[model samples]
Target: MGFILLINFTQQGDSDDPQSAAVEQFVIGENKVILTMNIDQQVTIERAGQGWRLLPAQRLSNQLIEQMMRTWQQVQGQVLDIEIDRSQQSGLFISMVLADQPNIQLFTLYLLAEQVVVHNHQLDRYFSLPLPMFNQLIPTGLLINQS
Candidate 1:
């Protein structure tokens, strides 16, 4: 039961210098498709055999699929230290299944009227992203009652 800390560092442009690009690092719940997918309040995409499909069999264009997958795969957020009760918070729950992992990574997204934050309960870490981006992150028209 040891865990490896995963870090993602993307170099910008064609420069070999690391400083040229901004580095964004976050944990992959044991440094890990995501062998599977993320389960949200209204979104659910899972990989079966060699293909991926949307839950309840929703018809999504290939382009939209690619866009969503890309966003989830490369999703990065600024880590924050905050305390909140999971039971009391009215937030969206996202469960991420990583490759070759027996456990499911649990997360909660608190979409406040003013700000949006994702809490990783496993790591006790909170992440904040631009409110506008959150809308784009989940994709519009995907949720039935999303505002």
Candidate 2:
């Protein structure tokens, strides 16, 4: 059976600018959230009071993390046809957990030859992200030690 999911987002401030609209969709308050990604391997980052810390003693450079968060906050993408096949190998899987929320939002992304396909389980919809933005956000070495 096929299921349909609808995305509910509110336009904050300027609706004409896609960046501002994208930023409004995800609001990470006080850094009270955990971001995890699994591509070739799994790496997780959690709020460390004022900053972010990687798991298992890996130190992610503050600058790199900040840049990634900025990209995520301003990411712009378009929804593709919902009938696309999802049986291909998933290239990336990301999940976010809010400190005050009980549910974990998950996104599965497939890196195709021409486009990046993202499946947002929370919204039950698929989106095609810009290649540049996808490259910025999905670097395999971003979770490594920077020191």
Candidate 3:
């Protein structure tokens, strides 16, 4: 992952002298996971503008896909300050392609009997989410691949 973020600074206000300067803050551009592949390589969800598409042509509707993407973006969790032993957990791998990043991001999800923990390797952080939200994040039973 060789993605580099570049920030541009612009001069604000009309100042004849270059002595006093106030820097204007602009959106550094948020990174969105435009494409994601499942752990089993069974399904792929990709974002195209305002819509989303499922690879292998699942029977899922566009509205549902959009909702799933929204959930992925808006979902929040409780921060876990401690480290988890990922070796003993049953987990899944998700590979994502951020909108503005050139490199792909990888994440590991450890599903427990209670909560779902996601390890954001990029940020080196962990989040603990509710157990039921797992279905919304990666809805099961969509693995019936079409020829």
Candidate 4:
């Protein structure tokens, strides 16, 4: 069997222009709602102390999730799937796949606080997850499925 590489829209090299090439296409394991580009560039989105941050592709920390869940008053049922939507100008977009039964809809935005604000879009109100915590929440099952 043959495999393909995926490129995210947000990642830019030395050039000013954004990387437009789709090296390969893949969806996060299991949940079909989250789509990932460029497996090499897969960064987990999570929440940090009083802010958001990004975690490199690797093992997810459950402790972070526990902290975020307590701070943000979020539960597993509230989050469907978290994905890196590199198409936006804010560095990244944490697409919140709502737990809509039967059909999952990508609604709301878990965006970086620097380039965006909570009220800028409707998604802001729901999941204002910090990048670090978001990244820690990366589902291992999903990562394995991508393989």
Candidate 5:
């Protein structure tokens, strides 16, 4: 007998918002994956051929990629009334591009000392997602093979 393993990572949010649309590609901030404190090595993950593959030839587990996509598709949070500090470093940057349109919608998630904030450029709104759930969305410990 074969068993199917299903995983759900959907979060409730405004469906009418363009930022809430499906994410076809994503470019995660460098600090989220790298441990050397350098913010220049940004890693981009997108659809390659038939499956997902990280840029620069990094080996990533299929499960990890699927989880990330699920988070992007089902991420929901409350819009914060507080102002965002632009000086603060961003934890993640998610971008979505439509096939018919030439513009790319950008979303930035800022990790603060006490809370996490996500800024949807398309909607021009600030959202606060649970710290634990945000952490799960960020991919880590990916193998970077340079051989």
Candidate 6:
């Protein structure tokens, strides 16, 4: 399956809104998958072993994307394509896919201040998160898609 890259943005007052991203559809074909990113700055991505992960809003920094793209470009064996949704200004839903084979799940990493937050997408929806025992809960990985 192919891959798609989506980048969604939030309106001025909608910065705190959670309904800013959605997954429309993903079609896996003979050697590629077609995806749509109708959102402004939001993107949908699937890591090899990871089923699907929703990347919403402009929470992703330009530097991060550039770095990722550079690394992705150097790859030559299997091809991972990307599509972006660009219909809505802030809350657009797009679609994407990853390599068909299974592998270590792709993870999204966020850097906040002096801390780092890394976790799978599935457990991100829990209400009462199991905050680390650390005395300070660092503001790492802004969950822009949440309330």
Please report the candidate that would top TM-score against the real structure: 1
Cα miss at 135, model 6 (Å)? 27
- Quality of model 6 by C-alpha lDDT: 0.29
lDDT per residue for candidate 2 within 1-147, as digits (tens), equals 122222222333245665543432332233344444333346776666676676554455687776775565455566554645556464566777755668776777676777776776766767677566565676546544311
Candidate 4 minimal-lDDT segment of 10 residues: 20-29
Report the candidate with higher TM-score, 2 versus 6: 2
**lDDT, residue 76, model 6:** 21
Taking the tens digit of each residue's C-alpha lDDT, what string does model 3 give over 11-102? 22243434332221111124355665454476788766667778878777777777666777667666565577766665676777776678
Worst 10 residues of 3 by lDDT: 20-29
Ranking by TM-score: 1, 3, 2, 5, 4, 6
User: Tens digits of per-residue lDDT for model 5 on 68-91?
Assistant: 765665666766657676665645
State candidate 6's TM-score.
0.20
Q: Which sections of candidate 2 miss by over 4 Å?
A: 1-41, 143-147
Error of 3 at 25 (Å): 22
List TM-score per model, in order.
Answer: 0.69, 0.62, 0.67, 0.26, 0.60, 0.20
| All candidates in order of lDDT, best leading | 1, 3, 2, 5, 4, 6
The global C-alpha lDDT for each of the candidates, from Candidate 1 onward, is 0.66, 0.58, 0.64, 0.34, 0.55, 0.29
Clashing pairs in 2: none
In the range 1-147, model 1's lDDT, one tens digit per residue, is: 122222223323345654423344453432465665555656777766655677766666656766776666677776655776767777777887877668888877787676678787788878776687576557766666775
lDDT digits (tens) for residues 8-56 of candidate 6? 3324436654343221111122343222212223354333232223355
lDDT for 86 (candidate 3) = 67
Global fold similarity of model 4 (TM-score): 0.26
RMSD of each: 9.7, 10.0, 12.3, 19.1, 13.8, 20.1
Which regions in candidate 6 have their CA more than 4 angstroms from the true location?
1-67, 70-96, 101-109, 122-147
